[model samples]
Target: MTVKPDWLRVKAPQLERIGNVKEILRDLALNTVCEEASCPNIGECFNAGTATFLIMGPACTRACPYCDIDFEKKPKPLDPTEPTRLAEAVHRLNLNHVVITSVNRDDLLDGGASQFMACIDAVNSVSPNTTIEVLIPDLCGNWNALELILQAAPEVLNHNTETVPRLYRRVRPQGNYDRTLELLQRTRQLSPSTYTKSGIMVGLGETDAEIRQVMQDLRTVDCDILTIGQYLQPSQKHLQVNEFVNPEQFADWKAFGEEIGFLQVVSSPLTRSSYHAETSQGINETLSTLKS
Candidate 1:
């Protein structure tokens, strides 16, 4: 019998401005992770005056079982002007911290790394003061592709592990757990100064010990930040939630992460990868803010 975890209440201030943000995005013909990935914290993130920009294209090459992004056999060619358009969108939104991500485009030789760089550059050029974060794919464990993105110099580099290794076959059949770790390790090696972040979703049949191990593994890769949250099934067609983790459990994980040497950890039932990112000024800044 499946048990519903107690619904942790959230007061999302961002919901109020969601419609206006949607209208602006529609006007610009842009896509956001908020709409594409079915992120639970979309209402909160948008209401907080922030949105994660989805670049490259809406269609993905790989179909991760847990994700709801549409998979196309042959995605459309890269949009040459998408970077500038994304920059314009960021400028218009008046975002202080822009979070950019993309669909997995394994069809391209560079694994869409060039396009990722272009978007970062464009955003930086237009909004110099605004800190930028890129939540990237593993690029099939390509070192060169990793270098291209690091060269662009985003404030934070994030790549989600999504779930524990044991659940990889069921939750993320197309993705590699080892490859994701390698990618994170490479990012830190390539640019030690860049803040490296990763996330995992609980309630996927993973044990508490397994979750703790995952956090330890992230620390092994020199990850600077971590976000852990409950996994909610996006649709009937998607993978069913194995369990619902309570708010107390999330708190325990957060404390564990800090003990394991993670500089920052955001663990809550309602948390998503990019949730409350706009408020995380930087590792030191966030720590100071939290303390004061």
Candidate 2:
């Protein structure tokens, strides 16, 4: 196992703002991926009044080796009132941007796409100015379900590719590399106005060449924003850390991504999918001004 590096270490979450956000979440009974997956930047994100809400789950239907979320063959029914509570939390936080994600709900007929639409609508009703980003699962290759979610019109639709294709069977046994790419492609075709984003985690025994090739694959489908981060082992039962990618290598990947035409690239040992999500909107404004 590679020794945990100093660069990866993070400061403890400070209170006041973070405490207030937690209080609102607790009162509404909502979940965020920051707490559920043990994200390294939870402190920074929460203290800044931002969070990636995880709707429809703390449990998952698929058990990927690298993921920390628990799996249940038959998860309980989706809550009818959860969407309003989530929207209320977004309003209370007064965020300009928000991320909403979920577990792989394969047990559901539409892979929980209905809930995504409902959540998007709820957030819009309460906080219309708050841009929404959904870091979604592959929806088990349900294109119609993907279409359903697109109809609600989020500002950014993100679905993480997670790892290189060769590692799929081991790293993400239930996930499909081609299917994931297809989902992104379909998203672009369905809603060109909605910026399509995808992310991948490195340090899973994937070669640098493989990572670059995956970035190219995403570009072929016109994926806009890219994120590359080191994958930390979640527990003894989860996949062991193959390597701790150095910060310099992450910088190289970032440069390469920019060169290949991604609007923004967030690459670092501590980067996660939702890390600095609000920055993308600012980037869009800058690019729009430049174009004009």
Candidate 3:
């Protein structure tokens, strides 16, 4: 394992605020991707009074070697009360924006799409002013299931294209690169008003050219938002980091993404799918203003 660089070091967040957020999650019996996936920005985001709620599980159906979320061939049944509890957390946290993501539940026919919808509706019911973002799975290419998620109409729909095509089989064996692009394309076609977002993790032995090509491919599907971040190895069992991407490279990717017409490009060593996600609504306002 390679030593993490100084740039990758995260500053500790205010413990009081983080504890408050955790208390709410625990009290409500909810899960957050931040803790389940071992996200580095947990403290920062938590201290800022935000969390990316993990809905269906902390246990995933797929055991992707690169991810930290636990895998269970037969995970527990979906808790019908989860949506209501998650909505209560959003209301208590008084969040201006909320991101809801779920583990891959291939055991279910709908791929947990209905759960995503129920969560969306629940949040809207209690916190109508809050903007909703759902970072979803490809649903094993179930277009009809994807349609169910779209019907709920989240303000932003994100699906991470976790790695380059060349590394897909090794990094995301259950996932298809083309399917990711198709999902984004379908999102644009199905709900033109909603923003389509995707993310990529660097330091996975992918070439600079490969990263740029992924960005270009996302643009081809009219993905509106892009996030590029460094991939940190979760455990010794997981895939080791290939390299530490420098800040300058992240800046270059941001510039290239902007040049390719992405409405927003968040690239940094610490950038995650929902890192500072609330800011995205401003882009919608900006685009609307320009159109007006």
Candidate 4:
């Protein structure tokens, strides 16, 4: 028998300006993870007045079994005007905090880092008060590419570890676990003031011990923020959910993560990598004040 956890209950509220928001994005010819990735919290996020911007292109080079992103052999060229367009979208939406992510562009010599920086610059130009968060790819573990993004100086630099190292072969076949760790560590080394964040999806057959170890690995790399969420299958072709973790388990993990020295931890059924990004700034600010 399946049990629906209390935390999984989604309440749909009417978003007054959500249609205008959608029309603006449509007019700009931009795509969003909110639509592409089929995020379960879309309704809530939209109602709460926030959305994650998908930059670069819709085509990704890696074929992670758990992700539903299209694995395109050759994607279109980077749009030079995408920065301005995305900035306009943020302004139109009146976003206080914006989360920007992109498809992995291994085809580019710079691994799309320049494009990421451009988006950050564009957003900053228009929304000077808005906090910028970037969910970046590994750039194939190249520090030079990472440096370009660091120079832009987003408020948060997030690179998801995705899963435990043992599952990398099967789950993220083309992704290197060590490379991800190095990327997160290097981001901190490059900009210690920038809050470094990463996330993982549970219900992928990882044990409690393994999950704890993943937290330790993140801590060792000095990742300040962490998000743990349930792994819901996006499609039949994607990896199946091994188990739907209970809310109590998620609560226990959240407490464990805080005890492990993570400055902030978001672990819940509907939590995503970019969920509650606006509130996150306050959490990071609080932690920064404490550190000082």
**Residue-wise C-alpha lDDT for candidate 4, range 196-247, written one tens digit per residue:** 9999999889999999999999999999999999998888788988889988
How does each model score on TM-score? 0.93, 0.95, 0.96, 0.93
lDDT of each: 0.86, 0.88, 0.93, 0.86
Which segments of model 1 are wrong by more than 4 Å? 1-16, 281-292
Q: State the lDDT of candidate 3 residue by residue for 119-211, as single tens digits.
A: 999998998878888999999999999999999878889999999999999999999999999999999999998899999999999999999
Off by over 4 Å in 2: 72-74, 280-292
Report RMSD (Å) for each prediction in the order shown.
3.2, 2.4, 2.2, 2.6
- The true-versus-predicted C-alpha distance at residue 271 of model 3, in Å, is 0.6
Q: How close to the true structure is residue 12 of candidate 2, measured as C-alpha lDDT? A: 82
Model 1: per-residue Cα lDDT over 1-292, one tens digit each: 4555458555655545998788878888889988898887777777766799888769999988788888855688999889988898899889877889999998899899999999989987898777788999988878899999999988789999999999999888889998999999998998987889999999989999999999999999999999998887788888888878888899999899989899889998888888888785346464333223
Residue 248 of model 2, lDDT score:
97
Best by lDDT: 3
The backbone clash count of each candidate, in order, is 2, 0, 0, 0
lDDT value, candidate 3, whole model:
0.93
